[model samples]
Target: MAGPVTAAVLVIGDEILSGRTKDRNIGYIAEYLTAIGVDVREVRVVPDIEEEIVAAVNALRVRYSYVFTTGGIGPTHDDITADSVAKAFGVAIDVDPRARAMLLEYIKPEDLNEARLRMARIPAGAELVPNPVSRAPGFWIGNVIVMAGVPTIMQAMLDQVAPKLQTGVRMLSETVRADAREGDVGGPLGAIAQVNPEVSIGSYPFMADDGRPNTNLVVRGRDPAKVAAAVAQVRAMVEGLRKPG
Candidate 1:
């Protein structure tokens, strides 16, 4: 039994909860992580409050193998993600030299005001996660990775961070169609699933050519051989129940 690689996502902003912004990061991260064999087990959306952000960051970082946070790292007064995450880890927040240098490379000295320099503040002893879309870098403290909330920037940062993560065996899926009603095949499908506890089998009903209900059974597993074997078992079971015209 291979241990599952788990991850959690924290979306920090009042805009999301207040319905002012529809979150696109969660779905994008979920799909991206799944493709790389990491199971995203939990997701949380918290307001811009410091205590709430700190608590959420602390709890998720401890619970998951990897924790990803998005939003609240901007120049606005509400951007307090860095401070909150630092507090969560009991670390000091300061303007990191590397981050400062990066910002200075692109931004003029006149533009590097207190507001913009806020982006340079990172948790002590944290490593920088590259933000190709913008010079403002994200930071990684322990298992928690802080990234930008903007979808494009988040994706770019993920490209840099994803390779560093350890992954599990990729999940495999197999599908087969049966000219039978879902109700008719439900019992056998459940029996097959019980017999092969390692694989997950799902049956979806659809209309057939003859206007009768048919089912498409899908088997998924981390092991390709196991998935194929389970699919065969389901196919055999369904074939056995086929009626002669």
Candidate 2:
């Protein structure tokens, strides 16, 4: 697009903050968005509080191209994401007929209790993001997309929402095994990085299978030519530094 298509993830849940439930959506969302050319710039977790959710949503929506929220739209008192999102956008929220209809696919009319009805609340002027795992629909309002906290449900929502988002150029990456300790290559790597400012260079240290310290140097950039050039420089540097057994 005009610039990089960036996104922020707002994870809302008391269980996540309390550690009772481990979060599994952030990484998945980040990787998925990256593959689709949307850079995930930030991630924030908030307890099930109205003010915190509102503030996070408002701030992130303005700062990034898209905001994806996970959790707090369930059938309980603590599930307040829909209402908080409505307040953030200063819009009215009510049980949307379309959402109710979707829920009906799973829940019989008599079984759709008051608590379950909470799942149908959607902000005005918002579009629904369907959950293939569960019938409860998430929503997209302005630049924010609210989704279920459950990993499977959230993933389904993202797939439904992906085709509609504005995307940017995909990043290209190259990895070279240094077969040497990270410390051994830091200087040369830093020098390469300084000259190739267009590409990002990173070193990941690991223990080689032969019981020696080693590093993997990664070069990444949106431009293929820049990434290739940086990779060539890194390969030459590593070759010159190779140690004899």
Q: For candidate 2, what is the TM-score?
A: 0.96
- Native-to-model Cα distance after best TM-score fit, residue 25 in candidate 2, in Å: 1.0
Query: Model 1, which residues run further than 4 Å from truth?
Result: 175-186, 203-217, 236-245
Per-residue alpha-carbon lDDT of model 2 for 100-160, expressed as tens digits?
9999999999999999999999999999999888799999999999999999899988999
lDDT of 1 by residue, 1-245 (tens): 16888999999999999999999999999989989988899999999999999998888887889999999999889999999999999999999999998888879999999999999999999999978877899999999999999999999999999999989877777889988888989898899999899998999999988888889999988988888899889889888989564
Residue range with the least summed lDDT across 10 consecutive positions in model 1: 236-245
Q: In lDDT terms, which candidate is top?
A: 2
TM-score of each: 0.86, 0.96
Candidate 1 at residue 186, lDDT? 89
Displacement of residue 196 (Cα, Å) in model 1 is 1.3
